[model samples]
Target: MIDGERDLIREMARLTHSPLGHAELVYPWGQGVLSGVSGPRKWQREVLEAIGEHLTGSATRHRPCRIARASGHGIGKSALIAMVVKWALDTCVDTRIILTANTESQLLTKTGPEIAKWANLSITSDWFTATATALSSTRKGHERSWRADLVTWSTSNTEAFAGLHNMGKRIVLVFDEASGINAKVWEVALGALTDADTEIIFLAFGNPTQSTGTFRGLFGKQRDLWNTAQIDSRTVEGTNKAYLGELVATYGLDSDLVRVRVLGQFPSASSMQFIERAVVSAARTREPAPALGTDPVIFGVDCARFGDDHSTLAIRCGRDARSRPWKRWHHMDSMTLAGDIAVEAGRWKPDAIFVDAGNIGAAVIDRLRQLLPDILVSEVWFGSTRVREANWNAGGSGGTRIRVANKRAEMWTNMRHWLESGCIPDHQGLEDDLTGPEYGFDAEQAVMLEKKDHMKARGLASPDDGDALACTFAEPVQPRAVPGWLDPERYGRQRGGSEEGGLYRDLGNG
Candidate 1:
């Protein structure tokens, strides 16, 4: 190595012994390029102090040190993360660092770019090369050993986190926007903390948007293990006080929205409302899918055995889904309900029908088969083992696979994804039912939906409409051509010798 680079490394070693030393040496304060730049805030300094102390004391210990921060908007969480990353890279040689966020866009647009910008401004910028997903030492022997990786967490490829092992060296794991991260990712990440005689630092930072998750557990069940801090923007220096006051006034101090966006507080209770009201409302008012008539129409049926529950049928044409107006049946015999379903199937000629096969649903299915044997109907059991086969990608030639806890969880997650992107009609019953069920995890940390009894205890009716809609995601179905009534121009212009003409002729004969 060159004399200047060696001297720089020696200087960094001395400076990293304390957080303030590292900050003072690396930051370009009152100098060329970035003149008059200030260091971390008081709260951020506290976090750095804890990290420095932990590294000094745990030079020989096996246990990992964890620091997690929950903060409101614009408190500079990303900046603090950038500082810690530079400190680790400059101070320690052959350190392995993994940085991940909830999504790829967040990492690409914000977290990863900020780190690169700060790293470029450092005195030892020549020592490392910054790429899109990683930063690595450019020196000969140290090229592979010293690097920091940036990634977005996904259910697949979690094994990328399992390969990090730096014995007797430093290991740093940073998670940004951690609230939405799955529990499985957190579980697998624990394996990376097992190297003995290594300095380990795990930092998780995000807004407290989710009330239940590993992030929330940092302030709840797992509080004893983490050195945690909550930073409200209003209290921090240089924050917009007027905007904060307006937010508090607009949302009120007690609203969940205010607590998350202003106060840096976890929601007061578990999120009983699975889908947000605003998101649902916006989707309800959005335009219907253009392919509504040109794609397959699938039917989702939820059967009711007793009580005040209603057996309902939900129809989804491509991304456009709505429950039939007269699909709800109360205290109807299985034969009668099956006959009604057969009539609808004959009239609509849906591509595929998914029926809940739990409890009395099997009897209803048996009755339906006796009435219409040729109808394409599939039985779904919510509590059965999830159907985890490869799904055919219509756009591509291969099949893609996904993992889920069970049928119910898989369908609900699918429904949630659809709600975020697709349109739903404005129906009062559908809105209430969609927002009712809360999510929880099972003992093995698998995703689980709240039971009907749980919803009833919370004074919400059984989510029959929601359940019927969720059933459409049970398994992949074959797509068919458009029906005549839904294809307005084709039926209106071509009046003779086509499928549209045949449909009208049959209706007139009937």
Candidate 2:
């Protein structure tokens, strides 16, 4: 080797425990690949400094250096990941680094390319060979031992993560888009931390897309075990301020979209959760507006199919869902539930009654139709794939509509939208029912809710009450015209409606 090259290697080795120093000294800023770029951003510098501190302490302790960062989009996380990978491999001899992401595409297309870019820009670039899937030392005997591999994590195939052991040397594990990584992968990777007297650095970086996951736990339950940071895109320099402003204006500052994409905050619900707990809590405490006397009163009935499930009846009048208390019955036959629904319909004189037409619900709907011939009793199949044209505007871009997978998804989405201004009774069971089901996108990218069976398998009860409430949104209901003889001021009192005067009297008294 040349004398200058040997001097460069010795200088890099001196910065073994100083990641921040290594990053600043090794990379060429404002030249070649990094033209016009000055240095690391403020947050990146802080993270690198934290890593340096952790490594300094590793000499005295056996604990792994755990660092997790949850940040908004477009804040240059890929660049930071590349710097860390380069620093770990270049300074420490026989260092083994495992780089993985939420998906193979992210690892190959985004992260892998970024690492190569930075490695090529580094002063010690000639010491290593970079490839699409791996980077290895070019030294004659250290090719296999001193390396970093880009691995695509899989729940079923966790051998790569399980075999991450390098005794008496450095082991750096990086998880990009960590929020979307499976919990099983995280568990399997923990096995690598048992190598005592070794320098272990574990880094996780991702947008906080999910509320319930290993990533969330790193900031919450397991926070003491790690050094964590949440970086808002707005606070960091070089982010597109105009685009972020547009997002806040479009989705509102507190919306989940803004919270996840701009503020680096976990959503009020999981990313897969259709309804957020914050929205539900707000609805429960909100004061309902006075229902117009002409507003239609609707009844939604969800019949129980199994012995464990409960039959539920939910009543709503315009914004006043809390005016009437919900009715629930366990171990009720379809015939008996139908009879009870018929009696409620007769007493309340609901403008429309929507009944679930799945399994035993079909029998209940049949009995209700026969008993209440004059009333508008309609059958709604939960699995039906038809969505009202007006309800397709929940989420989309460029005027495109977001399609829902089935009638149940449509109803629940409609109910979620309504909760913005509507009022609901504050009940824990109803809260559980509303927030139990997680959502996913189908093959065609249509929004689909988790089936009740899936929720049960996850140890959550069937959302019968939530389904009954959502059933009210099955179809639009026109307001009923007021009688000509009744005075507007005294109409509610005469009909035994709300205390403040509205449609459908508060049924809590009854």
Candidate 3:
């Protein structure tokens, strides 16, 4: 190598011990002024220190260096991430780096360009060639081994993250806008950390836009597993003070948006989450209390039409609801599911059975009618108009008036009300499904439940259990009374002074 190449390699080796060394060498930071751009913010220096410790000073070998940062707008998170990427490439030989963002547009438009801009200004700029998806080392000996690739990940295609093993070499993985990346991608990325001796660094930087998932968990359940940081824009120098003031004025300092954008805090509730976990937990713990003066025995069915999704059956008797687990049958015929429902309805003798008739549900309804001639079966199409007369008033002079965008929305709203006032069997799947979808208001200002497609895109499984429970609200039904001839006391005696046992038997314990 020539004298210049030799000097470059020497400096790179010296900077390997500290990210601060690499940053000082590349940027012209003299006195208090930063040349070319504004000086590095305090938060940026802190991030560099954390990365430096993980890369070189970490005492343990078993745990890889994991840094998760949640920051507000204009905190220069992207610029800091770019600096780390360049530092890793220059300091570590034979290194492999992968950069990703929440979406392809974000990766291409924002993250990719920011990295390229910084790479152009670095002292060793001539050593690499920047492309749209990759930055390749142009040096004679390290052309192939030293490079960083930008890979956009998605739920449908995860192959980009597979087979990322670089034992005995440095590996840097950076996730920008990390909150929007699905949990599945995070799981896939874990496979890359298998190399025991690899100098590995995992950096996740994003705004606290999502309250649930891997990014949020870093500050919660997985706090001990990561070196976490929260950077508020207002605390940092060079941020737009006017913009921050306007936001605080419009949405209050304590609002969710302000908490996320200014205070660098996760919202108390997820932006789109419809139901709260605390409410669900309370419902599960409370004792069963059926509604007075009403039988209120209702059955709800959500049919499965495609791929791994389950056909679920939920039964509610007054305020007490049976725990109905979702059942999946691969390529099962419609008539078979109908037969199963018919048997359940016959035993429970529900006041009403509401079946979601959007897809293959019509066939199930037909077969159900044939099997139980006296059954009160209703075909409920979710896309149909929401029946306004079915609105339920929980209590008080002005109850939580439920008005939804469509039938599906109305049913879900009713299900939420049920969870608040009634009792449900303790089940994890049911809880997850119940709290899955987020809600919004349509043009008409009615509550609109998010589409299933959106939920699937976010790596959430089909909420069949929740949907089945919601179907029970398709229409209101008065409880069927016992025959006038049968004495109330005698009927109670036959059922052991309570009808709960018979109710359980009617719904089938399973």
Candidate 4:
């Protein structure tokens, strides 16, 4: 290496614990990397300074430094992220860095390129090599050990985060666009913080688009553990002022869209989210009501129509939905799913079973009816016109009733109301499914729930589990009368099924 480069590296080693100092010194301000761009913006400078303060002294060295930044659009968050990554990798030796985003496309098209752009323009660019997925040391032996890897998080495959350990060294984990990241991934990533005597820094940056999730918790109940900041686009320099003004004019300043996309604030609930997070959270943690005993046990089966979707079976006994565990199958044939449903029906002897009659759902319903000849298995079409009574008001004070665009909307409306006092299983997937879809009104002002295709287009998973649960509310079912053979007091205990004798035969006309 040249003498100037060598001296620069030595200076960077001195600023190892000073991210702010390192950022200012390593990149040329008026040239290449930051060409025509003054320097780090005010908000960016503050974040870097905070990181430096947290790491500079030995007293706070061992403690993990967590910073959660929720910002409005066009605040140069990606640029700041790039600066941090470069500073961390160049200054700290053998620093293990992992960068992730809400989606793979974000990593590929945005975060990954941002990092490479800054790395190429840095003074020590020759020291590291940037690939499509990683930035590694140019030195042969340090290639694997000293590097930063861009990873895509998955709920099912969290092994990448679970194994994040760099003992006696520095470990930096950054989550870009973190609001969309699943709670399970965040939980798995927490295991990395246990490394003793290591310099740990966890950074989460994103638009506050979600009302509930690990990202939201970083500012809510978990705020004490993190240094959180919310940046409004209007307050930040270089933001599009006219565009922001237009947004405020189009959708009132207090609207959810403006709150999330412009004000860097969490919405009361997601604009399109039919069921609010607070309501779902309450239901998940609620205790079963004593009056639930009289409520009918209903089963909802939603058959998967596509390869990526899941076939789910949800069971609810009145307001108590926690007693029975949900069953989900991926890529399973209709016959197999029907057989499974039949088995659950034989086990629970539900008062009624509502199955989605879309696509291959009809075949599942057919097989289920044949399997449980005596049971009441009903087919429900999601696109069919509303058959139930309209309970919601269509704005204004006229008391005009609101009509649901289809049967799916009607069922979801019922489920949303039921959630206020219902008890449900505490599961993240179920929570995501319930809160995934957005709602809108049609030309006639009829309530229209976002279709599965639209939800997927917005990067949300298909609400299969949610739909199954909603199916349980398709129509009201009368509570089964206590049989003379069975004691009324032991009804709750015997609800699952009878092994000694056939309960299906005994429960007549269910």
Task: Point to the candidate with the largest TM-score.
Answer: 3
- Pairs clashing in candidate 2? 497-505
Candidate 2 residues 395-455, lDDT tens each? 4552334578888888988888788778999886787688768999888778899999877
**Window of ten residues with lowest summed lDDT in model 2:** 501-510
What would the per-residue lDDT of candidate 4 be over residues 1-510, giving only the tens digit for each residue?
337867887888888888888788767897864578767899999999998998877798888999999988999999899999999888888999999999999998999999999898887899899999999999879999899999998877888899889999999999999999987788889998999999999999999988866798799779999999999999998899999999999999899899999999998797667888778889889998875344678899888856788999999997888888889898888898899888888888888899999878999989988888888899999999754445453246733455788899989887887887889899878887897778998776778899998776545678999999999988778766544445344455654445324432233333
Which regions in candidate 4 have their CA more than 4 angstroms from the true location?
1-3, 32-36, 57-59, 277-386, 393-510
Q: Give lDDT: candidate 4, residue 307.
A: 77
TM for candidate 3 is 0.72
- Total clashes for model 2: 1
What's the TM-score of each model vs. the native?
0.56, 0.61, 0.72, 0.62
User: Could you tell me which 10 consecutive residues in candidate 1 have the lowest summed lDDT?
Assistant: 387-396
Residue-pair clashes per prediction, in order, are 1, 1, 1, 0
Q: Candidate 1: where is the Cα deviation over 4 Å?
A: 1-3, 31-36, 58-61, 269-510
Q: Please report, as a residue range, the 10-residue window in candidate 4 with the lowest summed lDDT.
A: 499-508
Worst 10 residues of 3 by lDDT: 501-510
TM-score of candidate 4 versus the correct structure, residues matched by position: 0.62
